[model samples]
Target chain A: MSESLVSRIKPVLGLDNKWWWDQAAEGVLAIQRCQGCQSLRHPPRPMCDQCQSQEWDFISASGKGTVCSFTVLHHPKFPGYDYPLIIVLVELAEGTRITSQLTGCEPDEVDFDMPVEMVMQRDADGFQLPYFRPSQ
Target chain B: MTINVSGEAAIAGVANTEFSKNSGVSELELASVAVRDAIADAGLKPSDVDGMTTFTLDNTDEIEIARAVGIGDLTFYSRVPHGGGAATGLVHQAVMAVATGMAEVVVCYRALNGRSGHRYSSGVAGPLLTSDAIHWGWYTPYGLMTPASWVAMYTQRYMHLAENVQDAMFEIAHVQRQYAAKNPAAFFYQRPFDRADYDASRPIVSPFKMLDCCMETDGGSAVVVTTAERAKDLKHPAVIVKGVAQAAAADMESMTSFYRPEIARIPSMDIAAKMAYEQSGLCADDIDAAVIYDAFTPIVLWQLESWGFCDLLEAPKFVLDGALRSDGRLPTNTHGGQLSEAYIHGVNGVVEATRLVRGQSVNQPAKEVNNVLVTSGVGVPTGGALLGRSD
Candidate 1:
């Protein structure tokens, strides 16, 4: 096994990197609103996958989604990693789905379709990995 | 009510690039080389091919492959999705094209420099950046960043239900590596593994060990599909495609299918096995040999149980008794399989199936192989087929 790296320097990117990144930076979630099917999308792409149309615009989101599924990791795959991390598949209010880590709670506390919102956290790598918290 | 028939779709030709960790060739180049070799193997020219089928995940598209391989035109060309599940499904699509007269000669191929170019073993970087990535982002902070980690959860549950039948899974790996050790083309050829090796291997997940996982490789393999009538006049004996089927169960995801009624049992495989048996008119007793997908060792055990080769909980016992060995009741993964051989998205399994029916396999079966069962991936939406000797 290789020696694990410690005290890693994390690089942070500005919201200008991508539209979705910008939305994350502003604390207001945004998804691509398809002109073809009028469906909303996340992690913004160039075109609508459903209709394959190039006409898409940014739409502000409710920052609310339901947990479609989840898995609790009892083992840390990497060094400086903590165990019992909860991961959930969040289906956004617009019906667009995304995967994020559930935070602010323990593993058994999470359930399917449980409402959640994105919460960013700095990992051991110094990068802000998106974590989710149960919605009030 | 469906009528079932048993026959064969002759394998007109076979070709594959040398297996290696680094091919130093573009995926398109690799695919073209294999296709050309397959065309020549059939004693036919490139223009003879009228159809093509491959995996949707493949970088090389069907039209691009046709153009690169110097084919004039194509009447049928398509791609199957669901990763490794499309392995045998590609051949099935080609057989259908030829059988239905949509095309005379069809080629099915998979070419990937998976090791040198793109490593799927790396953390799930691609999916994390897309909306799909965002969806997965919900999980990654929880530390589920790799496919192995996702599969590990289900494997643990399976082991628990089987009352800690870890030996059954290890036994399947033992048999596969054993065959691979004898076959010169296998990566582990001349390097046989035993139960101790499996036991000593490091754990990837709770139940899956390093040895249980398949290797990542770079190579391309191609199979030519033509009518049984045409195969009779070809260069090699016709290894007909007897039956083929693909299925996706409810609540299916890429690797995270925890929403299913039973995570231990792959309902998709059950659906696929039934369809394949019905189409081929052959049950487990009729199969002379098999080349089951072994992406993970536990999947092999589950597949055996689901296919009715043994009782659900009796898988470990069945494997311990050497039922899956080359000299056993039903020889499996005679080409070493993904575990010991190369993982060309399960396409190599199809190549071995063809060899078994032709009586020309490096790890040939003990008895005459009248019928052979070949399955594609097990997890997610999967596919399978039964290949046989054309009378």
Candidate 2:
């Protein structure tokens, strides 16, 4: 209600997950892989769950994913944001899932197992965020 | 060896301030009133309380509340994390404290002017502390702000997997609201069920209508816990703590834990239920009534399966079949739940559980309720409890 759907709000970054924002800033969707367990995790943590290993690395994702789930949020709208926001949980081709927004698509356009592709977009504040659109 | 807390401790008394959209009071005032009333309900003086437990999110302080209630010495105190999921965990904490002889009388309370004060419906708007923002940092920037959105992601995945679920979401709302319609304490009291209303309701999050969400109200709820031996000498019938457990499963995030193998399943609920049932020595069949968390409608479905009330992914039909009705197998949240009743988080559910076990519920079911299962919220580190009736 205050302004356009795009707000200048940015994610608060810390020492551990700053690298994730760095990847997005460069227009690359990246995921964290546990160097010890050979498995992947996200949001950039220090330890691994499978083997309790504190070792990890970042790998560039394929930018391909499926619509694992989604929602059309309307009420309690935020400043500089439109109503009925389309938020999606995408299961990346790398077997891990990530949370992002959907652009260039309608609400009814979303479906279960819908295929999507990740795209990095910059906000007015120059903060890069990962988003998904219908994969061509 | 660990002690079996079942029957070791009991809830001697329970009390709740009026559920309202605006309490016109401070959270500390709410806490003070609820705790003091609960102590009096137990036929005990405020001086008898030596221990206290509450949610870490609660604004009231232990020392402040102790001072407000005019208590003597403070031996045991704890603050459970995970928002609404800390409901039953409070009882678990108090039971442990009293059972271990660390404290004589422990009072657990959750006080919030959620409507007039900090409303959860707005979601996490601005940044708080760095340490507390772990979960939000991952999802907040991407239009995932509200608790409804966090849950919507899971509900989407779950509905996709279940496939058979359609009207169950609305029906879950219907049944719970049906229960609320009968209870004067509920916000939706006397509001009859109308499927058309549910269908016409505006969508807040996909697969979740406005009715699918829990009401946000300002109120306080509290319970007094003591050793079963001492509780028997007090006021009302003692509701013994049979089994209680808390859990945070593998790959646990706060709520937006979509990175797991499948976002559809709630491992937290499964783990908590397994542990609680093991502690209570009761299976799904043993539970006569339930107060499962209903922060959202799909959560009830997810929990029904995770808690072993039905087969995996079969809660849709199970719930649609009126399994939650009083005449059905399990009369759940007969006090209307958070959806219809005031959202005092989950403590109100436990109060309703105590009523059922005591055979004093207004919407009392036909069956003999020997045991009641009460759960806190899922999607975060959560907990559950099984309460039993005494002769």
Candidate 3:
């Protein structure tokens, strides 16, 4: 997992979101949860929509999920990523979704509701990020 | 208490600079010219315009547009965010201004050098400076940054369950182009393509072909809104703002509302449709024509279904059955659309809806168009409005 297959873009980390990337780097997939209302949120937010609680914590999710949806991009030919890139939305077993690239599969080989598991990879800048691979 | 300002304000004027690849001028100049023309089209002096609304994405400020158009002061001025989704929101802002006696004549305008300057499709490459960048950060690392890619997340899921969507997507583009063939202001005017051209077009993002994407043209479009009573004395027939709703659904991310329970549905548009129907007291059956935002072909199907013009997974079938043709049940995008007309960020759509209600569209439907539904961007916080004649 140290040697990179291809360099990737680094995320613009923020106070609340930085924690998720930090957790992914430590071999753990973390999801945010509101302490007061016990509600879970993705892409991490400061407050809870259910109870207006600014207080929250995280849950270590099982890295197993299913690809709910995906896209194969060809144009804009962005640097650091291969063409016909397949990015997927994986619905985690704990009932929340996470966005990441689907690795180890061709764009044509991917299908809806496919089973996938998370993998940690380091970009060119040594920034660790999460990716999804098809379940064996 | 709900603000039922429905039927109180009307759109009295609609104008647009020609759609082209290069305007050879600044966006500020385009806004001034379009605004000036819209004021004249409303048959009102510049001094009479006291309010203004434009997209936050627009380069020109209201004071700058006001100064350039020779207007003195403004009692109410605002900008709606969310890019193209702000089209009908501009109308909402204008109607509210006139409704509360804040401003007499409010102009909603959008001008951009999308082709000649910064093409929007290219902005997704990297490093979006907006505050929303925080939300996009999670996706960009995986190269899921562009609007097409973001929308594909939903479209891929949609096509998975639907039938004949590929054919329907092409037919929507072709049908809009058919309407564009008759519009001199359209980018594709005098140029109509057949099924062969569609098959030949390359797919940019798997489901979306090159021809399916909207035109990135350099142009400007503006509309004038005023009180229903004052609009009656204008040069042209007044198209009353019978219903307008701006909806920012929960858990919405700019274009990447992928975390929603139903990945294929546009909750914002559904919310806007419900609010609009409640405000106007008009059902989908009352709509005679429409200008559904065509940023991409799939968007038309989404809006049509969201606005209740058709059922879920039924939009493609609706298009395949010729529901959008001039002689079809509901004539749509008679001035073309963002696809064939121009991408003024859906503001041109509001202008065209005004034309349909005023009975002045170039390719007017054979059936009389009174309640014309106009919508802004989807997959984001969006808006929609129903326009019809006060008479």
Against the hidden reference, what TM-scores do the models get?
Answer: 0.72, 0.73, 0.74
Candidate 3 backbone collisions, by pair: none
**CA lDDT of A55 in candidate 1?**
64
DockQ scores of the candidates: 0.01, 0.01, 0.01
Provide the lowest-lDDT 10-residue window in model 2 chain A.
A45-54
The superposed Cα distance between candidate 1 and the true structure at residue A92, in angstroms, equals 57
Q: Write the per-residue lDDT of candidate 2 for residues B258-367, one digit (tens) a residue.
A: 88998887898898888788877789988888998999988888888987989888999898888999898888889889999889989988888988888888899988
Candidate closer to the true structure by TM-score (higher is better), 2 or 3 = 3
- What is candidate 3's lDDT per residue for A1-136, written digit by digit as tens? 2434656766766444778888888878898988987877786754454444557899998889999999989988766776677899999998889998899999889999899998886666677778899998
lDDT by residue (A1-136, candidate 1, tens digit) is 1323553233344221255655555665677787877867655543343443446677776768889999987764544445565778889888888777787877888988788987766544444455679997
Ranking by TM-score: 3, 2, 1
Please list the residue runs of candidate 1 whose C-alpha ends up more than 4 Å from where it truly belongs after superposition. Answer: A1-136, B1-8, B126-131
Please list the C-alpha lDDT of all candidates, in the order they appear: 0.78, 0.85, 0.86
Compute the lDDT of residue B90 as modeled in candidate 1.
92
Judge candidate 2 at residue B17 and give its lDDT: 84
Which run of 10 residues does model 1 chain B get worst, by summed lDDT?
B1-10
DockQ of 1: 0.01
